[model samples]
Target: MFSLMYETPSSWVQDVEALGTLTLLSDHAHCELKAAATMQALVAKNPTCDSIVRTLPRFAMEELEHFEMVEALLRERGGKLAEQDTSPYADGLHKGSRANRKSLLLDRLILSHIIEARSAERFYLLSEHLQDRELAEFFGSLMPSESAHRIMFLRLAEGLFPAEDVQARTAELRQMEADLISNLPFEARIHSGPKQ
Candidate 1:
Protein backbone atom coordinates (compact mmCIF):
# COMPACT_ATOMS: atom_id res chain seq x y z
CA MET A 1 0.00 0.00 0.00
CA PHE A 2 2.94 2.37 0.37
CA SER A 3 4.68 2.37 -2.99
CA LEU A 4 3.48 5.30 -5.08
CA MET A 5 4.94 7.61 -7.66
CA TYR A 6 3.32 10.65 -9.19
CA GLU A 7 4.73 12.44 -12.21
CA THR A 8 2.68 15.56 -11.68
CA PRO A 9 3.68 18.05 -9.00
CA SER A 10 0.08 19.24 -8.86
CA SER A 11 -1.01 15.81 -7.77
CA TRP A 12 1.82 15.06 -5.33
CA VAL A 13 3.03 18.36 -3.82
CA GLN A 14 6.20 16.53 -2.76
CA ASP A 15 8.28 19.14 -4.54
CA VAL A 16 7.37 21.57 -1.77
CA GLU A 17 6.97 19.13 1.10
CA ALA A 18 10.10 17.13 0.42
CA LEU A 19 12.43 19.90 1.44
CA GLY A 20 10.45 20.48 4.64
CA THR A 21 10.31 16.80 5.46
CA LEU A 22 14.00 16.18 5.04
CA THR A 23 14.84 19.32 6.92
CA LEU A 24 12.70 18.19 9.77
CA LEU A 25 14.40 14.81 9.81
CA SER A 26 17.85 16.30 10.00
CA ASP A 27 16.72 18.66 12.71
CA HIS A 28 15.28 15.74 14.62
CA ALA A 29 18.58 13.91 14.47
CA HIS A 30 20.48 16.95 15.63
CA CYS A 31 18.08 17.65 18.46
CA GLU A 32 18.03 14.04 19.53
CA LEU A 33 21.81 13.94 19.72
CA LYS A 34 21.90 17.11 21.74
CA ALA A 35 19.30 15.79 24.13
CA ALA A 36 21.19 12.55 24.49
CA ALA A 37 24.36 14.40 25.27
CA THR A 38 22.61 16.42 27.92
CA MET A 39 21.16 13.31 29.49
CA GLN A 40 24.56 11.66 29.47
CA ALA A 41 26.11 14.50 31.42
CA LEU A 42 23.27 14.47 33.89
CA VAL A 43 23.46 10.73 34.24
CA ALA A 44 27.15 10.78 34.89
CA LYS A 45 26.65 13.12 37.78
CA ASN A 46 23.76 11.15 39.23
CA PRO A 47 25.68 7.88 38.65
CA THR A 48 23.21 5.53 40.26
CA CYS A 49 19.61 6.67 39.95
CA ASP A 50 18.05 8.27 36.86
CA SER A 51 17.00 5.35 34.66
CA ILE A 52 16.80 7.78 31.78
CA VAL A 53 20.51 8.45 31.87
CA ARG A 54 21.23 4.74 31.83
CA THR A 55 19.15 4.28 28.68
CA LEU A 56 20.25 7.44 26.92
CA PRO A 57 23.50 6.12 25.50
CA ARG A 58 21.65 3.56 23.42
CA PHE A 59 19.13 6.18 22.41
CA ALA A 60 21.93 8.45 21.25
CA MET A 61 23.40 5.74 19.08
CA GLU A 62 20.06 5.06 17.47
CA GLU A 63 19.63 8.77 16.86
CA LEU A 64 22.98 8.85 15.08
CA GLU A 65 21.89 5.95 12.93
CA HIS A 66 18.73 7.78 12.11
CA PHE A 67 20.76 10.83 11.16
CA GLU A 68 22.86 8.78 8.81
CA MET A 69 19.83 7.18 7.22
CA VAL A 70 18.21 10.54 6.59
CA GLU A 71 21.45 11.97 5.27
CA ALA A 72 21.83 9.08 2.86
CA LEU A 73 18.29 9.55 1.69
CA LEU A 74 18.95 13.22 1.02
CA ARG A 75 22.10 12.48 -0.97
CA GLU A 76 20.31 9.84 -3.03
CA ARG A 77 17.66 12.35 -3.96
CA GLY A 78 20.30 14.85 -5.09
CA GLY A 79 19.21 17.13 -2.30
CA LYS A 80 21.79 19.02 -0.27
CA LEU A 81 21.85 18.57 3.49
CA ALA A 82 21.59 21.79 5.47
CA GLU A 83 22.76 22.91 8.89
CA GLN A 84 20.05 23.60 11.42
CA ASP A 85 19.59 27.01 12.92
CA THR A 86 17.19 27.78 15.72
CA SER A 87 13.83 26.99 14.20
CA PRO A 88 11.08 29.40 15.15
CA TYR A 89 8.92 26.34 15.50
CA ALA A 90 11.06 25.00 18.34
CA ASP A 91 12.28 28.29 19.77
CA GLY A 92 8.85 29.63 20.60
CA LEU A 93 7.72 26.39 22.16
CA HIS A 94 10.92 26.13 24.18
CA LYS A 95 10.59 29.66 25.41
CA GLY A 96 7.29 28.90 27.04
CA SER A 97 8.66 25.77 28.67
CA ARG A 98 11.84 27.46 29.87
CA ALA A 99 9.91 30.21 31.56
CA ASN A 100 8.56 27.78 34.10
CA ARG A 101 11.44 26.10 35.85
CA LYS A 102 9.67 24.86 38.95
CA SER A 103 8.51 21.74 37.16
CA LEU A 104 11.28 21.45 34.64
CA LEU A 105 11.28 17.69 34.12
CA LEU A 106 7.53 17.54 33.73
CA ASP A 107 7.59 20.46 31.34
CA ARG A 108 10.37 18.94 29.29
CA LEU A 109 8.68 15.57 29.02
CA ILE A 110 5.37 17.11 28.03
CA LEU A 111 7.05 19.29 25.44
CA SER A 112 8.95 16.32 24.08
CA HIS A 113 5.72 14.36 23.70
CA ILE A 114 4.15 17.24 21.85
CA ILE A 115 7.10 17.47 19.53
CA GLU A 116 6.98 13.75 18.70
CA ALA A 117 3.24 13.80 18.17
CA ARG A 118 3.56 16.75 15.83
CA SER A 119 6.33 15.02 13.95
CA ALA A 120 4.15 11.96 13.44
CA GLU A 121 1.39 14.22 12.16
CA ARG A 122 3.74 15.99 9.77
CA PHE A 123 5.19 12.71 8.51
CA TYR A 124 1.72 11.35 7.81
CA LEU A 125 0.76 14.53 6.00
CA LEU A 126 3.96 14.57 3.96
CA SER A 127 3.69 10.88 3.09
CA GLU A 128 0.24 11.47 1.69
CA HIS A 129 1.56 14.21 -0.60
CA LEU A 130 4.93 12.71 -1.53
CA GLN A 131 5.54 11.51 -5.08
CA ASP A 132 8.59 9.27 -4.98
CA ARG A 133 7.65 5.73 -4.12
CA GLU A 134 10.75 5.21 -2.00
CA LEU A 135 10.38 8.50 -0.19
CA ALA A 136 6.69 7.98 0.38
CA GLU A 137 7.35 4.56 1.80
CA PHE A 138 10.07 5.90 4.07
CA PHE A 139 7.80 8.51 5.56
CA GLY A 140 4.96 6.05 5.81
CA SER A 141 7.24 3.79 7.79
CA LEU A 142 8.26 6.51 10.26
CA MET A 143 4.81 7.14 11.72
CA PRO A 144 4.55 4.23 14.15
CA SER A 145 8.02 4.75 15.57
CA GLU A 146 7.37 8.43 16.13
CA SER A 147 4.03 7.68 17.72
CA ALA A 148 5.74 5.26 20.08
CA HIS A 149 8.20 7.95 21.11
CA ARG A 150 5.31 10.31 21.75
CA ILE A 151 3.66 7.78 24.00
CA MET A 152 6.85 7.12 25.90
CA PHE A 153 7.34 10.79 26.53
CA LEU A 154 3.75 11.14 27.65
CA ARG A 155 4.20 8.32 30.11
CA LEU A 156 7.28 10.00 31.48
CA ALA A 157 5.34 13.21 31.90
CA GLU A 158 2.60 11.36 33.73
CA GLY A 159 5.07 9.78 36.13
CA LEU A 160 6.64 13.14 36.89
CA PHE A 161 3.39 14.93 37.55
CA PRO A 162 -0.19 14.24 38.61
CA ALA A 163 -2.85 13.50 36.02
CA GLU A 164 -4.38 16.96 36.20
CA ASP A 165 -1.02 18.60 35.99
CA VAL A 166 0.06 16.41 33.10
CA GLN A 167 -3.10 17.17 31.22
CA ALA A 168 -2.68 20.91 31.70
CA ARG A 169 0.94 20.78 30.61
CA THR A 170 0.13 18.62 27.64
CA ALA A 171 -2.53 21.06 26.55
CA GLU A 172 -0.15 23.99 26.79
CA LEU A 173 2.53 22.19 24.78
CA ARG A 174 0.05 20.98 22.18
CA GLN A 175 -1.04 24.54 21.51
CA MET A 176 2.58 25.53 21.14
CA GLU A 177 3.12 22.70 18.71
CA ALA A 178 0.14 23.80 16.63
CA ASP A 179 1.51 27.32 16.52
CA LEU A 180 4.93 26.00 15.48
CA ILE A 181 3.42 24.02 12.63
CA SER A 182 1.31 26.92 11.45
CA ASN A 183 4.28 29.29 11.40
CA LEU A 184 7.58 27.75 10.31
CA PRO A 185 10.67 29.89 10.25
CA PHE A 186 13.01 29.97 7.26
CA GLU A 187 12.45 28.12 4.04
CA ALA A 188 12.25 24.31 3.99
CA ARG A 189 15.47 22.29 3.80
CA ILE A 190 16.53 18.97 2.29
CA HIS A 191 19.08 17.32 4.58
CA SER A 192 21.69 19.98 5.22
CA GLY A 193 21.58 23.66 4.30
CA PRO A 194 24.15 26.38 4.78
CA LYS A 195 24.26 27.80 8.26
CA GLN A 196 21.61 30.49 8.78
Candidate 2:
Protein backbone atom coordinates (compact mmCIF):
# COMPACT_ATOMS: atom_id res chain seq x y z
CA MET A 1 0.00 0.00 0.00
CA PHE A 2 3.05 2.26 0.07
CA SER A 3 4.25 4.31 -2.92
CA LEU A 4 7.79 3.07 -2.80
CA MET A 5 9.64 1.89 -5.93
CA TYR A 6 11.88 -0.44 -3.97
CA GLU A 7 11.28 -3.38 -1.70
CA THR A 8 13.63 -3.84 1.22
CA PRO A 9 15.82 -6.89 0.78
CA SER A 10 15.01 -9.87 3.02
CA SER A 11 18.63 -9.84 4.09
CA TRP A 12 17.89 -6.70 6.12
CA VAL A 13 16.17 -8.87 8.71
CA GLN A 14 19.34 -10.87 9.19
CA ASP A 15 21.39 -7.69 9.29
CA VAL A 16 19.15 -6.33 12.03
CA GLU A 17 19.46 -9.64 13.84
CA ALA A 18 23.25 -9.35 13.75
CA LEU A 19 23.09 -5.70 14.78
CA GLY A 20 21.19 -6.69 17.97
CA THR A 21 18.11 -5.24 19.67
CA LEU A 22 19.73 -2.40 21.62
CA THR A 23 21.50 -0.99 18.57
CA LEU A 24 18.33 -1.20 16.47
CA LEU A 25 16.25 0.51 19.15
CA SER A 26 18.81 3.27 19.55
CA ASP A 27 18.84 3.97 15.83
CA HIS A 28 15.05 3.85 15.74
CA ALA A 29 14.81 6.41 18.55
CA HIS A 30 17.01 8.77 16.59
CA CYS A 31 14.84 8.36 13.51
CA GLU A 32 11.71 9.23 15.45
CA LEU A 33 13.33 12.37 16.85
CA LYS A 34 14.53 13.44 13.44
CA ALA A 35 11.05 12.88 12.00
CA ALA A 36 9.59 15.21 14.63
CA ALA A 37 12.19 17.88 13.86
CA THR A 38 11.56 17.60 10.13
CA MET A 39 7.85 18.21 10.57
CA GLN A 40 8.50 21.31 12.67
CA ALA A 41 11.01 22.58 10.17
CA LEU A 42 8.49 22.26 7.35
CA VAL A 43 6.03 24.34 9.29
CA ALA A 44 8.61 27.03 9.96
CA LYS A 45 9.67 27.15 6.35
CA ASN A 46 6.16 27.42 4.93
CA PRO A 47 4.16 29.36 7.45
CA THR A 48 2.01 30.88 4.74
CA CYS A 49 0.85 27.53 3.41
CA ASP A 50 -2.45 27.07 5.21
CA SER A 51 -2.59 23.29 4.81
CA ILE A 52 0.90 22.92 6.17
CA VAL A 53 0.27 25.42 8.96
CA ARG A 54 -2.94 23.70 9.96
CA THR A 55 -1.69 20.14 9.78
CA LEU A 56 2.00 19.82 10.60
CA PRO A 57 2.11 20.87 14.25
CA ARG A 58 -0.13 17.96 15.15
CA PHE A 59 1.97 15.69 13.02
CA ALA A 60 5.08 17.02 14.69
CA MET A 61 3.63 16.25 18.08
CA GLU A 62 2.75 12.74 16.98
CA GLU A 63 6.30 12.23 15.83
CA LEU A 64 7.57 13.50 19.17
CA GLU A 65 5.31 11.06 20.93
CA HIS A 66 6.65 8.28 18.78
CA PHE A 67 10.15 9.40 19.72
CA GLU A 68 9.30 9.24 23.41
CA MET A 69 7.83 5.78 22.98
CA VAL A 70 10.95 4.60 21.24
CA GLU A 71 13.09 6.19 23.90
CA ALA A 72 11.22 4.28 26.56
CA LEU A 73 11.69 1.08 24.61
CA LEU A 74 15.42 1.76 24.40
CA ARG A 75 15.65 2.29 28.16
CA GLU A 76 13.66 -0.87 28.77
CA ARG A 77 16.28 -2.71 26.78
CA GLY A 78 19.07 -1.03 28.78
CA GLY A 79 20.09 1.15 25.90
CA LYS A 80 20.44 4.93 25.90
CA LEU A 81 20.24 7.08 22.82
CA ALA A 82 23.64 7.63 21.28
CA GLU A 83 25.02 9.76 18.51
CA GLN A 84 24.89 8.16 15.09
CA ASP A 85 25.69 9.51 11.64
CA THR A 86 22.85 11.16 9.78
CA SER A 87 21.11 8.76 7.42
CA PRO A 88 22.76 8.70 4.04
CA TYR A 89 19.39 7.61 2.68
CA ALA A 90 17.86 10.90 3.81
CA ASP A 91 20.86 13.03 2.90
CA GLY A 92 20.95 11.57 -0.60
CA LEU A 93 17.28 12.43 -1.12
CA HIS A 94 17.88 16.00 0.01
CA LYS A 95 20.82 16.30 -2.34
CA GLY A 96 18.63 15.14 -5.21
CA SER A 97 16.02 17.86 -4.51
CA ARG A 98 15.76 20.92 -6.63
CA ALA A 99 17.19 24.01 -4.91
CA ASN A 100 15.07 26.59 -6.69
CA ARG A 101 12.56 28.32 -4.42
CA LYS A 102 9.55 27.44 -6.54
CA SER A 103 10.30 23.72 -6.38
CA LEU A 104 11.72 23.51 -2.89
CA LEU A 105 8.52 23.12 -0.91
CA LEU A 106 7.07 20.52 -3.22
CA ASP A 107 10.30 18.58 -3.21
CA ARG A 108 10.54 18.68 0.54
CA LEU A 109 7.01 17.43 0.94
CA ILE A 110 7.58 14.63 -1.54
CA LEU A 111 10.78 13.64 0.24
CA SER A 112 8.91 13.48 3.53
CA HIS A 113 6.30 11.27 1.92
CA ILE A 114 8.95 8.95 0.56
CA ILE A 115 10.66 8.75 3.93
CA GLU A 116 7.45 7.93 5.75
CA ALA A 117 6.43 5.34 3.19
CA ARG A 118 9.80 3.63 3.37
CA SER A 119 9.66 3.70 7.17
CA ALA A 120 6.26 2.08 7.22
CA GLU A 121 7.54 -0.63 4.92
CA ARG A 122 10.48 -1.38 7.19
CA PHE A 123 8.28 -1.36 10.27
CA TYR A 124 5.92 -3.85 8.67
CA LEU A 125 8.83 -6.12 7.87
CA LEU A 126 10.16 -5.97 11.39
CA SER A 127 6.73 -6.50 12.84
CA GLU A 128 6.44 -9.75 10.94
CA HIS A 129 9.97 -11.12 11.14
CA LEU A 130 11.63 -10.07 14.38
CA GLN A 131 11.88 -12.88 16.91
CA ASP A 132 11.37 -10.51 19.83
CA ARG A 133 7.64 -10.39 20.31
CA GLU A 134 7.56 -7.08 22.17
CA LEU A 135 9.56 -5.26 19.52
CA ALA A 136 7.54 -6.85 16.77
CA GLU A 137 4.29 -5.66 18.32
CA PHE A 138 5.69 -2.17 18.85
CA PHE A 139 6.76 -1.90 15.26
CA GLY A 140 3.42 -3.27 14.08
CA SER A 141 1.57 -0.66 16.12
CA LEU A 142 3.52 2.11 14.43
CA MET A 143 2.78 1.02 10.85
CA PRO A 144 -0.55 2.80 10.53
CA SER A 145 0.75 6.09 11.87
CA GLU A 146 3.70 6.07 9.50
CA SER A 147 1.44 5.26 6.58
CA ALA A 148 -0.88 8.11 7.54
CA HIS A 149 2.02 10.52 7.72
CA ARG A 150 3.11 9.42 4.26
CA ILE A 151 -0.32 10.07 2.81
CA MET A 152 -0.69 13.40 4.59
CA PHE A 153 2.53 14.76 3.14
CA LEU A 154 1.54 13.74 -0.35
CA ARG A 155 -1.90 15.31 0.02
CA LEU A 156 -0.33 18.51 1.27
CA ALA A 157 1.94 18.58 -1.75
CA GLU A 158 -0.99 18.02 -4.10
CA GLY A 159 -2.96 20.80 -2.42
CA LEU A 160 -0.15 23.30 -2.92
CA PHE A 161 1.14 22.32 -6.33
CA PRO A 162 -0.45 21.35 -9.63
CA ALA A 163 -1.58 17.74 -9.66
CA GLU A 164 0.63 16.86 -12.59
CA ASP A 165 3.59 18.61 -11.05
CA VAL A 166 3.13 16.74 -7.81
CA GLN A 167 2.81 13.43 -9.63
CA ALA A 168 5.89 13.93 -11.75
CA ARG A 169 8.01 15.11 -8.88
CA THR A 170 6.84 12.34 -6.58
CA ALA A 171 7.68 9.78 -9.23
CA GLU A 172 11.14 11.23 -9.74
CA LEU A 173 11.85 11.34 -6.03
CA ARG A 174 10.59 7.79 -5.56
CA GLN A 175 13.11 6.63 -8.12
CA MET A 176 15.85 8.55 -6.39
CA GLU A 177 14.83 7.05 -3.06
CA ALA A 178 14.94 3.58 -4.57
CA ASP A 179 18.43 4.14 -5.92
CA LEU A 180 19.67 5.48 -2.61
CA ILE A 181 18.27 2.51 -0.76
CA SER A 182 19.90 0.13 -3.15
CA ASN A 183 23.33 1.75 -2.78
CA LEU A 184 23.49 2.50 0.94
CA PRO A 185 25.59 0.14 3.08
CA PHE A 186 23.60 -1.98 5.48
CA GLU A 187 23.37 -0.71 9.05
CA ALA A 188 20.89 -0.82 11.90
CA ARG A 189 19.00 2.13 10.46
CA ILE A 190 15.38 2.57 9.49
CA HIS A 191 16.38 3.17 5.88
CA SER A 192 19.29 0.95 4.95
CA GLY A 193 20.29 -1.62 2.35
CA PRO A 194 21.63 -5.16 2.68
CA LYS A 195 25.10 -5.58 4.16
CA GLN A 196 27.72 -5.84 1.47
Candidate 3:
Protein backbone atom coordinates (compact mmCIF):
# COMPACT_ATOMS: atom_id res chain seq x y z
CA MET A 1 0.00 0.00 0.00
CA PHE A 2 1.14 3.57 -0.66
CA SER A 3 2.44 5.46 2.36
CA LEU A 4 0.45 8.64 2.09
CA MET A 5 -1.62 10.85 4.38
CA TYR A 6 -4.50 11.10 1.96
CA GLU A 7 -6.70 8.79 -0.02
CA THR A 8 -8.63 9.96 -3.08
CA PRO A 9 -12.31 10.33 -2.40
CA SER A 10 -14.58 7.91 -4.25
CA SER A 11 -16.44 10.97 -5.57
CA TRP A 12 -13.46 11.47 -7.87
CA VAL A 13 -14.97 8.82 -10.10
CA GLN A 14 -17.95 11.09 -10.60
CA ASP A 15 -15.61 13.91 -11.62
CA VAL A 16 -13.98 11.58 -14.13
CA GLU A 17 -17.37 10.71 -15.47
CA ALA A 18 -18.15 14.38 -15.92
CA LEU A 19 -14.78 15.07 -17.55
CA GLY A 20 -15.22 12.23 -20.06
CA THR A 21 -12.98 9.24 -20.72
CA LEU A 22 -11.27 10.72 -23.77
CA THR A 23 -10.18 13.71 -21.73
CA LEU A 24 -8.83 11.51 -18.96
CA LEU A 25 -7.03 9.29 -21.47
CA SER A 26 -5.42 12.31 -23.11
CA ASP A 27 -4.26 13.61 -19.73
CA HIS A 28 -2.91 10.17 -18.84
CA ALA A 29 -0.90 10.04 -22.07
CA HIS A 30 0.75 13.35 -21.22
CA CYS A 31 1.51 12.12 -17.70
CA GLU A 32 3.31 9.10 -19.18
CA LEU A 33 5.35 11.29 -21.51
CA LYS A 34 6.24 13.59 -18.64
CA ALA A 35 7.23 10.62 -16.47
CA ALA A 36 9.59 9.37 -19.19
CA ALA A 37 11.11 12.82 -19.55
CA THR A 38 11.53 13.17 -15.78
CA MET A 39 13.46 9.88 -15.61
CA GLN A 40 15.76 10.94 -18.45
CA ALA A 41 16.27 14.31 -16.81
CA LEU A 42 17.30 12.63 -13.57
CA VAL A 43 19.83 10.59 -15.51
CA ALA A 44 21.17 13.70 -17.18
CA LYS A 45 21.46 15.55 -13.91
CA ASN A 46 23.26 12.75 -12.09
CA PRO A 47 25.29 10.90 -14.64
CA THR A 48 27.92 9.71 -12.14
CA CYS A 49 25.37 8.18 -9.79
CA ASP A 50 25.68 4.51 -10.62
CA SER A 51 22.34 3.40 -9.27
CA ILE A 52 20.49 6.14 -11.14
CA VAL A 53 22.44 5.50 -14.32
CA ARG A 54 21.81 1.78 -14.20
CA THR A 55 18.15 1.95 -13.23
CA LEU A 56 16.45 5.05 -14.65
CA PRO A 57 16.97 4.46 -18.36
CA ARG A 58 14.99 1.24 -18.20
CA PHE A 59 12.29 3.03 -16.24
CA ALA A 60 12.27 5.79 -18.83
CA MET A 61 11.70 3.27 -21.58
CA GLU A 62 8.89 1.70 -19.62
CA GLU A 63 7.27 5.10 -19.19
CA LEU A 64 7.60 5.75 -22.90
CA GLU A 65 5.93 2.43 -23.60
CA HIS A 66 3.13 3.41 -21.25
CA PHE A 67 2.85 6.69 -23.10
CA GLU A 68 2.41 4.86 -26.36
CA MET A 69 -0.24 2.62 -24.89
CA VAL A 70 -2.20 5.57 -23.55
CA GLU A 71 -1.86 7.45 -26.82
CA ALA A 72 -3.21 4.47 -28.66
CA LEU A 73 -6.12 4.36 -26.31
CA LEU A 74 -6.74 8.07 -26.83
CA ARG A 75 -6.72 7.63 -30.61
CA GLU A 76 -9.08 4.70 -30.44
CA ARG A 77 -11.48 7.01 -28.66
CA GLY A 78 -11.01 9.57 -31.47
CA GLY A 79 -9.11 11.89 -29.18
CA LYS A 80 -5.64 13.27 -29.81
CA LEU A 81 -3.43 14.53 -27.03
CA ALA A 82 -4.61 17.90 -25.81
CA GLU A 83 -2.53 20.94 -25.16
CA GLN A 84 -2.88 21.70 -21.47
CA ASP A 85 -1.67 23.82 -18.63
CA THR A 86 1.17 22.58 -16.44
CA SER A 87 0.09 20.27 -13.65
CA PRO A 88 -0.17 22.30 -10.48
CA TYR A 89 0.21 19.09 -8.47
CA ALA A 90 3.56 18.20 -10.01
CA ASP A 91 4.74 21.78 -10.08
CA GLY A 92 3.88 22.24 -6.43
CA LEU A 93 5.84 19.15 -5.49
CA HIS A 94 8.93 20.36 -7.34
CA LYS A 95 8.63 23.80 -5.87
CA GLY A 96 8.42 22.32 -2.41
CA SER A 97 11.70 20.38 -2.94
CA ARG A 98 14.98 21.49 -1.48
CA ALA A 99 16.93 23.54 -4.02
CA ASN A 100 20.50 23.02 -2.78
CA ARG A 101 22.75 20.69 -4.77
CA LYS A 102 23.19 18.27 -1.89
CA SER A 103 19.52 17.56 -1.50
CA LEU A 104 18.18 17.98 -5.03
CA LEU A 105 18.67 14.40 -6.20
CA LEU A 106 17.18 12.95 -3.10
CA ASP A 107 14.27 15.33 -3.33
CA ARG A 108 13.66 14.45 -6.95
CA LEU A 109 13.72 10.77 -6.18
CA ILE A 110 11.25 11.21 -3.35
CA LEU A 111 8.97 13.28 -5.54
CA SER A 112 9.07 10.62 -8.23
CA HIS A 113 8.18 8.02 -5.63
CA ILE A 114 5.25 10.11 -4.46
CA ILE A 115 4.00 10.58 -7.99
CA GLU A 116 4.20 6.90 -8.83
CA ALA A 117 2.46 5.91 -5.62
CA ARG A 118 -0.38 8.29 -6.33
CA SER A 119 -0.63 7.05 -9.89
CA ALA A 120 -0.80 3.45 -8.76
CA GLU A 121 -3.54 4.31 -6.26
CA ARG A 122 -5.62 6.22 -8.77
CA PHE A 123 -5.16 3.64 -11.48
CA TYR A 124 -6.39 0.96 -9.14
CA LEU A 125 -9.44 3.07 -8.39
CA LEU A 126 -10.17 3.63 -12.04
CA SER A 127 -9.57 0.00 -12.89
CA GLU A 128 -12.23 -1.02 -10.44
CA HIS A 129 -14.81 1.70 -11.09
CA LEU A 130 -14.74 2.63 -14.75
CA GLN A 131 -17.61 1.30 -16.77
CA ASP A 132 -15.49 0.80 -19.85
CA ARG A 133 -14.19 -2.74 -19.46
CA GLU A 134 -11.27 -2.26 -21.81
CA LEU A 135 -10.11 0.85 -20.04
CA ALA A 136 -10.61 -0.75 -16.65
CA GLU A 137 -8.47 -3.74 -17.62
CA PHE A 138 -5.83 -1.46 -19.12
CA PHE A 139 -5.62 0.62 -15.96
CA GLY A 140 -5.52 -2.52 -13.85
CA SER A 141 -2.59 -3.85 -15.87
CA LEU A 142 -0.64 -0.63 -15.24
CA MET A 143 -1.12 -0.61 -11.48
CA PRO A 144 1.71 -3.06 -10.77
CA SER A 145 4.20 -1.22 -12.92
CA GLU A 146 3.37 2.05 -11.26
CA SER A 147 3.70 0.47 -7.84
CA ALA A 148 7.07 -1.00 -8.84
CA HIS A 149 8.30 2.38 -10.00
CA ARG A 150 7.20 3.87 -6.70
CA ILE A 151 9.18 1.33 -4.71
CA MET A 152 12.23 1.63 -6.95
CA PHE A 153 12.49 5.37 -6.39
CA LEU A 154 12.09 4.95 -2.66
CA ARG A 155 14.81 2.31 -2.52
CA LEU A 156 17.09 4.48 -4.64
CA ALA A 157 16.56 7.39 -2.28
CA GLU A 158 17.29 5.30 0.80
CA GLY A 159 20.39 3.84 -0.86
CA LEU A 160 21.74 7.25 -1.77
CA PHE A 161 20.82 9.19 1.35
CA PRO A 162 20.81 8.43 5.04
CA ALA A 163 17.75 6.45 6.11
CA GLU A 164 16.79 9.21 8.52
CA ASP A 165 17.13 11.81 5.80
CA VAL A 166 15.11 9.76 3.36
CA GLN A 167 12.36 9.11 5.86
CA ALA A 168 12.12 12.69 7.06
CA ARG A 169 12.11 14.17 3.58
CA THR A 170 9.69 11.57 2.28
CA ALA A 171 7.38 12.38 5.15
CA GLU A 172 7.58 16.09 4.41
CA LEU A 173 6.93 15.65 0.72
CA ARG A 174 4.17 13.19 1.33
CA GLN A 175 2.38 15.83 3.35
CA MET A 176 2.86 18.37 0.59
CA GLU A 177 1.56 15.90 -1.99
CA ALA A 178 -1.48 15.16 0.11
CA ASP A 179 -2.23 18.83 0.52
CA LEU A 180 -1.89 19.44 -3.21
CA ILE A 181 -4.22 16.59 -4.00
CA SER A 182 -6.71 17.80 -1.48
CA ASN A 183 -6.73 21.37 -2.78
CA LEU A 184 -6.34 21.20 -6.54
CA PRO A 185 -9.57 21.43 -8.49
CA PHE A 186 -10.52 18.19 -10.15
CA GLU A 187 -10.49 18.02 -13.89
CA ALA A 188 -9.70 15.00 -15.98
CA ARG A 189 -6.13 15.16 -14.72
CA ILE A 190 -5.00 12.08 -12.82
CA HIS A 191 -3.77 13.97 -9.77
CA SER A 192 -6.60 16.38 -9.27
CA GLY A 193 -9.10 16.50 -6.40
CA PRO A 194 -12.84 16.17 -6.77
CA LYS A 195 -14.54 18.97 -8.68
CA GLN A 196 -15.73 21.86 -6.55
Candidate 3 differs from the real structure by a C-alpha RMSD in angstroms, to one decimal, of 1.5
Which of 1 and 2 is ahead in lDDT? Answer: 2
| Candidate 1 regions with alpha-carbon error over 4 angstroms | 1-15, 18-49, 99-101, 189-196
lDDT ranking, high to low: 3, 2, 1
Greater lDDT among 1 and 3 belongs to 3
lDDT of 2 by residue, 1-114 (tens): 687898886668767977887888888888888898998999899888889989999999998899899999889888899888877887888887754335888888999999
Tens digit of per-residue lDDT, candidate 3, span 80-181 = 999978899888787767543358788889999999999999999898888778888999999999999999999999999999999888888898888878
How close is each model in CA RMSD to the real structure?
6.8, 1.5, 1.5
Q: Per-residue lDDT for 33-90 in model 1, tens only?
A: 5545544664565466455555556655655666677767767766555676765656
Most lDDT-accurate candidate? 3
Off by over 4 Å in 3: 98-102
Least lDDT summed over 10 consecutive residues: which range in candidate 3? 93-102
Q: Candidate 2: misplaced stretches above 4 Å?
A: 99-102
CA lDDT, candidate 3, residue 89: 88
Root mean square deviation (Cα) for candidate 1: 6.8
In candidate 3 the C-alpha lDDT for residue 110 amounts to 91
User: Model 3 residue 72 lDDT?
Assistant: 89
